[model samples]
Target: MGSPICPDCYDYLGHVVWQYHAPELWRRAIQDVSRQLAARLGVPVSKVSKVVSRQYGRTAEMQARGAVHFHALFRLDGPLDEGIGAACGVGVDVMVEAIEAAFSRAQVQAPPTFECDQSRVLRWGEQIDIRIVREGSRTDDPDAPITGEQVAAYLAKYSTKDTSLAVPDGAHVHRIKQTCAEVHEAAILRAESRRAGEEVPVPVDSEGRDHYVLIGKWAKELGYRGHYSSKSRCYSVTYRTLRRRRARFQQVTKSRCYSVTYRTLRRRRARFQQVMQEETERAQRAGKPVDLAAVEEALLSQEDESETSVVIGVWEFVGVGWTNQGEVEIATAAAARAREYAQLRAGKQ
Candidate 1:
C-alpha cells in the first residue's frame, strides 16, 4: 500500500529525476537538522556531531502511475564528555523537530551548468515523511508505530540499488519513444488541419528527446541515479573509512602474504594427517585389524605433542593443484562428485 496517483499527472521521468537527486536532498535535510540543533544548544556548528544516513525506497505500481518514494535512516552522535549515545538516544524528538524545520527550508538546486528553461525548473515532490527510529525496535506498526532497526535495515538495503527507470535496455524507453513519435505524428496531422483553419487539437512534444530544456537533460539518470549512501555527522562511520579498512585487510591477506604462506603449510599438515587416516581405514576394512583405535589415539597424541612449523614469507599448496583453502574445498567437492559418478558406473557394470 502507498500513495494515490494519476498516471497523466504523475510524470515517470520526474520520479526518476528525483531518485538521482534524492541522496543530495537527504544530506541537505539532515544537515539542516544538525544546524538547528546546534543553534538551540548554543554550540558551534562545527561542534555539532555529524549524523550518519542509510538509503531506502519503495516502488509501487499504481493506477496508471508508478510511485517511487525513499526513506532514510539517520543516526546522531555527540562529544565524549556529554555521552553522545545517551544524548542521541533520548533527544530523538528534538532531532525530529530540528529535521522538520530544516525540511521546511530545504531547497535542492540542480547543477548550475546545465541549461534548463527556467519555466520548468524541477523541485521535490509534494509529500515528505520523517519518522524517528527507536531503540531495539524494527517497526512502529501503522496502528501501533515502532520504527527503529527496521528503519535502519530498510534504508541500508536500498543504498546500492538504482531504479530501472531508464534502463538502457528496459521497456520504459521503448514506450516513451513510441509515445513521443505518435505525439509527433499527431501534431503534424493537426498542423495540416490548422492550415485549413480548423480547430484541431494539436499535440505538443512536452517530453521530446531533443528537449534538453526538459527531461532529456536528465536522461542518463533513467532518471534516478542519486546518492545511494549518506549519513549525518553523528550517524555511523564514513564510506571512505570502511573502504580503507577493506583495502588494508586485503593488503595484509594478499595471496603472496606471509599469513597466506602459513595457512598453506597448515593445510599441508592436515593433508598428511588425512592420508594417514585413510590408510588406517583401509587396513581396518581389510579385516587385518591392527589395533585401529590405538593407532588413531597414537596419531592424535603425536599431533598434540608436535608443533607444525611454517615459513613467514612463503606460500605453498600441499595438494595436487596450487590452490588456497577455499579453492581446495571447491576442488575437493568436485573430486567427490567424480568418484560417485565412477562408482555408479561400476555398479551398473
Candidate 2:
C-alpha cells in the first residue's frame, strides 16, 4: 500500500510530522466537531458546549502502508444532573455529520524538520470510518451497526497493543525511523543555535512545546510520538480513584469469579487455628490464662515482621503491577483466557 505505482511520491517528512502532531490534530477536530454541532443546532458555540458534551476514546494503529490510523469512539453525553442532555434534539445522524465535517476540515501545521525548512501540513488520512454503535445482533445488511460492547472491547484491546509486530518490515518503515532520528538531531542543533544567539527558526509551539526535540527516542515506533490510546478527561475518573476503591464490601460467597472463595476462608481458618494453638501453649507454659478475646485480636492484628521494622530507607514511587510473580502469572493467564472467550463470543454474535 506504500504507493503501489510510485513509492518515491510519498512525502516521508509530512508523514512523520503528521504522526507527531496527531494528538493536536485530533483535539482540533473535536473542537471543530463541536462548532459543527453548534451550527447545525442553531445554537451559540459557548452555550452549546454547556448543554452538549462529547466523551471519546482514541487508539492509534499502524496501517498496512506504514502510516498511522486512528480508531475513535465518540459518545455524545450531557451534564450529569443539569438535565441539559442530547434528548433535547441531537441524534446519531447529527453526530455523524459533525464528525465527518470536522475531520475533513481539521488541520494543524507542523514545524519544519532540521533537514528541511518547509512547513508541513498535518492532518488525518483521507480514509475515515464513522459507525454507529448499538446493542443488538448483526443483520444481513452490509453496513450493519456494531454493538457498544464490541467497540469497547476492540478499542480496549488495541489501546494496550504493541504495534511493532503489527507493522510490516519494509523500506518505508525503515525510512520513517531514519527520519525520526534525523529530525531529533536537527531539533537539538536548532535549540542550541537559538540559545547561542544564532538566527534559527524557533521550534516551539504556542504552548512552548518542543514538538520534535525527542523524535529520535521513538524511532522504533516508526516516528509516531503520540500515545497509542487516550480518552477525554471527562470520560472517566482518575486511575488513582479506581485503585483507591478497588475493593468493595460484598457478602462472603464460596463461589464467584472475583469473590472470596471457600478455599480462601479455609486457609484463613487454618492460620487462625495455628496462631490460637501457639498462643495457648505459650500461656500454659507461663502458667497464665489465655483470653479468648486476646487470641482473636492477635489473629486479626497479625502483621509481618517487616511492617514493624525500623524505617531506614527512603521510599519512592514505582510502576504499578502485581506484588509478586505468582499474582502476575495468575493475572496474565486469566486475561489471556478472558480475551479468548471474548473473541469466541464476538464471533458468535
**Top-scoring candidate (TM-score):** 2
Alpha carbon deviation, residue 109, candidate 1 (Å): 6.2
Instruction: Give residue 345's lDDT in candidate 1 (0 to 100).
Output: 100
Q: What is the TM-score of each candidate against the true structure?
A: 0.45, 0.64
Candidate 2 residue runs with Cα over 4 Å from true position: 1-9, 80-89, 138-141, 207-210, 236-238, 247-349
For residues 1-349, what per-residue lDDT tens digits would candidate 2 score against the true structure? Answer: 5432555787777777877777788889988988998888888988776667777778888777667788888877654223212233468788899999999989887777764477777766778888888878645465677887677778877777766556666777887888888888888887777678777665676665456787888788777777888877656654654553352123223234756666667876787789889888986796555545456557546633422337678888987988899999999999999999999999999
Q: How many backbone clashes does candidate 1 have?
A: 19
Task: Residues 180-259, candidate 1: write the lDDT tens digits.
Answer: 34433444555556567776332234352222223333344333334334344334445665685586455445553335
Report the number of the highest-lDDT candidate.
2
Enumerate residue pairs that collide in model 2.
none
Tell me the whole-model lDDT of each prediction, alpha carbons only. 0.49, 0.72
Residue 108 error, candidate 2, Å: 0.6
